[model samples]
Target chain A: MIIAERKPVDEIVEMVSGVKRVLVLGCRGCVSICSAGGEREVEILASLLRLGASKQGRTLETIEATLVRQCDREYIEGIDQWAGQYDAIVSMACGVGVNFIANLRPLDVVYPGVNTSFFGGSADQGIWTEQCAGCGNCVLHLTGGLCPVARCAKSLMNGPCGGSVGGRCEIHKEVPCIWQAIHDRLDRTGRKEDMSRIAPIRDWSAAGHGGPRKQVRDDLTV
Target chain B: MSFTPDIRVFCCHYTSQQAIAEGLAGLKNDGFPPNATIERLLCSGKLQVSTILKAFEDGADGVCVVGCPVNECHNLMGSQRAAHRVLAVRKALNELGVEGERIEMFHLPRGFHPEFVEAVKQLDERTRGMGPSPFNGGTAK
Candidate 1:
């Protein structure tokens, strides 16, 4: 899932400060799973904005709506009638959702309520950590099912760097060195022989380095 | 008219509410104000941030969530989850520039009527000192 965190309320308030009517849009997608934007979050944010505005002797009208998945066109299409009613919108979704809504309704001004972080999973309730970089490649099978690209501090594909000490990353004591983890796993799986074969230089074109990526499937396309 | 703060207390049914009922029965009037209202929840863990904000939006000066003592919760970790949720909501309140201390959590043992009443009294006193919610008399709801 994509990980995200709510932007500071002060920044959010500044986005729709002058607008009398603001719609708070939430997504039940990745943002909801991470607790950044959901039905409950939409209500909480709307209430906070209203309360914050009230303290300044200004009245703010906030409406709450949660889409099934803001990244999907079908889900956001039904909101066509409601989109025109608000002066501005507060999008409590990932950057994709916010951009999707903006593209769907060009007339409404949309402000992001959360900062899109990375492709990750929940470490625990209310805690999340990045797990994947979506490099358009999979190297887990070669490295004991752990992608050093996402886990390593330096994204090294070879082995542990000099910075890895005591099985922890030098940059942060709390972070477990993924290279060490990979070594242990390879040893346990009797695949330590695979480590001796040096890997060739990786291709960078598949990782969105060239430009904005586009995918087309002739079988699925209309 | 003298100012009286409105405190909304959400009590979990099994433990906290049991104590609150016993406490209310033993008191004639005591420290509770006229606006103090108790809402019963199956478990305090189910308490959402929206509910707390809604209480303040509806003019509550203070909000309290009382649940079973940490490990003694009937729903396993419901009380613990409630504590975490309360802390998160308090942080959000602070970010909104409102008094985060206006909301509190009390982990009360079963049949501890006196402690339950005492917790409510603390909330009442603290709320009185803070006057009304900043959203009061405003068109926020």
Candidate 2:
């Protein structure tokens, strides 16, 4: 899932400073699971915006709404119900949702309320950590179900770097060395020989190095 | 003219048992601030950041959350959860340029106790020093 965190209230307040009425949009997708952008977050943000405006001696009218998912055109269309009630929109979805709203509604002014952090999963209750880089390539099968591309500090395809000490990354003491964990996992599974197979130099084009990535399914396309 | 802060207090059922038992008049007799309002919940863990923010939006000069002692909550981790939510609201208040001190969390023993009233008194005095909430626009409600 994509992990996001809300932008500072001051920055968001600044974004909608001149707009008397604004839409606080939320997405019930990955962000909702991560507790960044959801119905509850929409309420928190809308209330904060109003309080911030009040503190400044101005009144801000907010319209709060959450869609099933903002990454799809069908759900993006749900925003039409709010129509002209808002002069601007504060999207609590990840960057993709904000872009979709912008791409589909050229005349609408939309602003991002969250900083799209990364593709991650909940590590624990109220804790999320980066898990995937979405590099458009598959390497998990070769690396004991762990992608160093996302977990390693240097994205090393081979074994742990020299910076690894006592199975911890030198970059941060709290970060366990992913390569060490990969090696241990393979060893425990009696697949240690796989580590001997060196990874070849990789192609960069598939990992968004070529430009914005897109996928179209002819069977599903209308 | 002296300023009277409009405070909102959210307490857990277990922690606020005394207040609930005393009724409004009894609390007044015991020196509970007349300007403050008490909202009782089954557990403070149910308190949400949005709820606290809504209180400020509704003209609360300050907000207080009284929950069971951290280690003795009836629901185990309920008070801890409430503490985290109050911290979240404090961060939001600071972000909005309001004093984060406007909101606070107190973990006190259950049932009737001076400590609960004292906690509110501290918040009341603190909020008085801060004057009316910026959201209140120098008006007391």
Candidate 2 local lDDT, B1-141, one digit each (tens): 698999999999998988988988988888888889999999999999988988998889989999999999999999999999999998888887788999999999998797888889899999998889988785322
lDDT scores for all predictions?
0.84, 0.92
What are the models' TM-scores?
A: 0.91, 0.97
- Per lDDT, the best of the predicted structures is 2
Query: Cα miss at B114, model 2 (Å)?
Result: 0.8
- Give candidate 2's error at residue A56 in angstroms: 1.3
Please provide, for model 1 over B1-141, each residue's C-alpha lDDT reduced to its tens digit, 9 standing for 90 to 100.
Answer: 366888899988875554456465444355554567788899988888888888888888889889989999989899999998889778877776778888999999865466767788889888877777776742211
Worst 10 residues of 2 chain B by lDDT: B132-141
lDDT of 2 by residue, A10-86 (tens): 89999988999999999999999999999999999999999888977899999989999999999998888989899
Q: Model 2, B56: alpha-carbon shift in Å?
A: 0.5
Model 1 vs. true fold: TM: 0.91
In CAPRI terms, model 1 is classed as: medium
Clash pairs for candidate 2: none
